[model samples]
Target: MPETKKFLYVNRKAPYGTIYAQEALEVVLIGAAFEQDVSLAFLDDGVYQITKGQNTKEVSMKNFSLTYKALGDYDVNKIYVEQESLDARGLTLDDLLPLAWEDEDDDWAKKDSIKVVSAAEMAKIMEQSDIVFSF
Candidate 1:
């Protein structure tokens, strides 16, 4: 069997007004589909991507924030949000969506996937990843 490599998708942009955020999400799902070990890091404006109550109708863009909920189904549950970024934006973990995954080993018990970490911790996570995709 081939060794599984840890893939980290780093999002540093806002959800709208650009394509970086959306493209990154699509790639993440694709990577997960290939059975790769996937992890997501949200920092800077990227934290806004998973926030709750997003209204993009005025912008005439499809609201893709809800697509994040499907990550758990792809077995991509490791989502890390940077605390400094959230604090700078005057937001908290409560502002983000409730993303969770089911643990098959634990009889399919639901578990929270979003983790709030310090900037230093996020850096360590990036360093630990075998491949890092910045968007």
Candidate 2:
């Protein structure tokens, strides 16, 4: 059998200010189709990408916050939120949307999908990954 490579996508910018977040998400979605082990780390302002209650109506932009939710259906369920990043912005886990995925090992039982970790821990995850993509 072929070895499965692990991919870590690091997002460090706010979701809407630039195209990076959207583009990165597009890449992740595309990559997920390949069935490689994939994970996403939301750091710095990137934490806002998964935040709940985003209003982009005034900006005339499509609100893609819910796009992250679709990742679960694609089996891209490993999402990491950096605690330090949230703390630095005066935010908490409550500020973000609750994301979950079906547990394939448990007869499709729904499981909380986001994992909260520290910056140091995120670094370790990056180090352990076979490929790391940062935006």
lDDT of 2 by residue, 30-120 (tens): 9998889999999999998999999899999988888888899999889999999999999999999988899889999999779999989
Error of 1 at 31 (Å): 0.9
Whole-model alpha-carbon lDDT for candidate 1: 0.94
lDDT values of the candidates?
A: 0.94, 0.92
lDDT of 2 at 104: 83
Name every residue pair that clashes in candidate 2.
none
| TM-score attained by model 2 | 0.95
Error of 2 at 87 (Å): 0.6
Worst 10 residues of 2 by lDDT: 1-10
What TM-score would each prediction reach against the true structure?
Answer: 0.96, 0.95
